[model samples]
Target: MAHWDPRGQVAPHVRRQVASLAAAVDELVVVSTADLDDDGAAFLGRHGRLLRRTNYGYDFFSYKTGLEASRPEDFDEVVVCNDTYVPLVGYGEVFEAMAGRPADFWGLTASQRVHPHVQSFFVAFRPWLVGSQAFRGFWGRMSPVSDRASVIAEYEVGLSRTLTDGGFRFASYYTETDADRALAQRRVAWWTLHRLPPPRRRREWEFLKARSKDPWNPAIALADVALAPSPPRPAGARLPYLKIDTLRYDPYGLGAERLLRLAERRRPEELAGVREYLAATAPLSAARPDTDLRPTPVGVRPLRRLVEYGRAA
Candidate 1:
């Protein structure tokens, strides 16, 4: 969840959405920052089986922390969600879509023009893909977003390139333009010797915000919320048949059954024996992602050292 720093009325709404989502899943793990107050903590405790909080950072750092927290062992599938989205139905469908793929690569619900970068209402993790030190390091390097727009675009492009280089496909349930809207809003929060004059700063923020044409002020929604497609799959990308095995319920014979139902566009519950079939399967593994990469030193010292070595050589 990319949480705002101050506590306010937003807390109650965020809590309700989370509670509803937790009830739908078999096991839930909630990760947030210290910004969550007593009410937030109590709400989360009731819904999540496990809860973790990290160092407070802005939207960028908080997002990076969540990425780092995901492990191959936590669940067969990991769903990354922004706090703003309220899941109306089972997200199990997403995992079912990504079933049998590598764990490291992400399965996302995509939006038009703007790819779902900073926040995704739905993302699924495959285990094998996530087990690489290189992948984790790649994400770690993206911490503390310097430029929101460019950072988002570059990360998605770079991520796609890296995954393709490593021989993996990025999958998405595409969304249309009408389903999403984005707005930008900036105001002078501080002044400094190097900063622009107040009038100029205000004008700049106003122009950008207007040009973006967001449905509401960017601060109101944090430019993260979007309408999830009903049935959750967009046109033209539907497979002939895709199985959505409920890992929590049916583990054994459901794969074949799921495949059969998917072919017919039928929900599993509509089938006669699926419920019984799912109840008998055992839980899957919960393993951590590989973290073997050497951490990169922060700042220009490493670059300076490299330059010195090159000159000496």
Candidate 2:
């Protein structure tokens, strides 16, 4: 598991997540970008191998560092997940459910924004995919780009495409049926309409959007059900996580609260620490202003032949 907090403090929910995940795997390696307190360090130490890296790259940077350091070739399965979400359900059911599935690799959910690909947050690699030359080359090609778009295009989307092109099959755990997908499309439209600015401007914004697609956003276009798990869950809608990003940066205002509320209603026992973390973080802003950023080591990763990429790396 890869975890990073800007303030270098570990929240109770995060700790619980890490510990809970630790129990499932034979070994868990946590690559932390931020410094941890003594208790945090001790807790992680008890759970798994803990490595510290400079906070220059994104999650994938930690991914590269951790994978290289741990030597994942020996493992039967390798799961790359991060602190970007809170898992509403524990891993036991999820793992058990997915065990019989025939996918060489799988994720909790998949999105069809630009194309079909698994969301990067919770991907599990079976030994078939994990031990391949493609797997090693994938990591070697990774350059933790500073921007989200490039990262998505290169690493996130590139991952599934690369593996698929290599003849490996992938699957999503909570596979949405045709009806569920239609519901998501409708929900997405509702969210886009409601997330508009106040009345007069909302009219203008609606008019503009009706004609132009310039402001079409990744989050908006990517209609994952985590962003819209309101009311009745569709059949087979057993996604384990509710993204923390949706809690803070819900650009569409598309029912992140409803998702949280649903989790609370279903399983309040697991939510106390999540609530505490939310209180500490104070998720008041829906969107963040574009801050001037420096070019960091965290960048992009593109797919390439093993031999060529090997020399480049």
Q: Would you estimate the TM-scores of all the predictions?
A: 0.46, 0.77
lDDT: worst 10-residue window of model 1? 185-194
> Deviation in angstroms for 201 in model 2?
16
Off by over 4 Å in 2: 194-237, 282-313
Q: Tens-digit lDDT track for model 1 on 1-313? A: 4443233113433554466557655555566655566666676667764344564333445545666655544565545555533232334444555565433455344322343231233455455556655556666667444553554565644555555567655555422233222111111111010132223577776754444342322111111122222334444222111112222212111123323334224333223333333343223212212211222224322342222101110
Candidate 2 lowest-lDDT run of ten = 304-313
Please list the residue runs of candidate 1 whose C-alpha ends up more than 4 Å from where it truly belongs after superposition: 8-13, 24-27, 49-60, 63-70, 97-108, 111-121, 154-158, 175-313
| Best candidate, TM-score | 2
Error of 1 at 26 (Å): 5.3
lDDT of each: 0.39, 0.66
Clashes of each: 11, 6
lDDT of 2 by residue, 1-313 (tens): 7877755677777887898898888889998987777877788878999999997667888888888898677888889988877776568668877887888998888776666788898889998788888887888877768777777888888888888888888887775646554444444444444444333687786773663332223222232443343433543356566666655545444434554565566556656577667766664322454321222212211211111101110
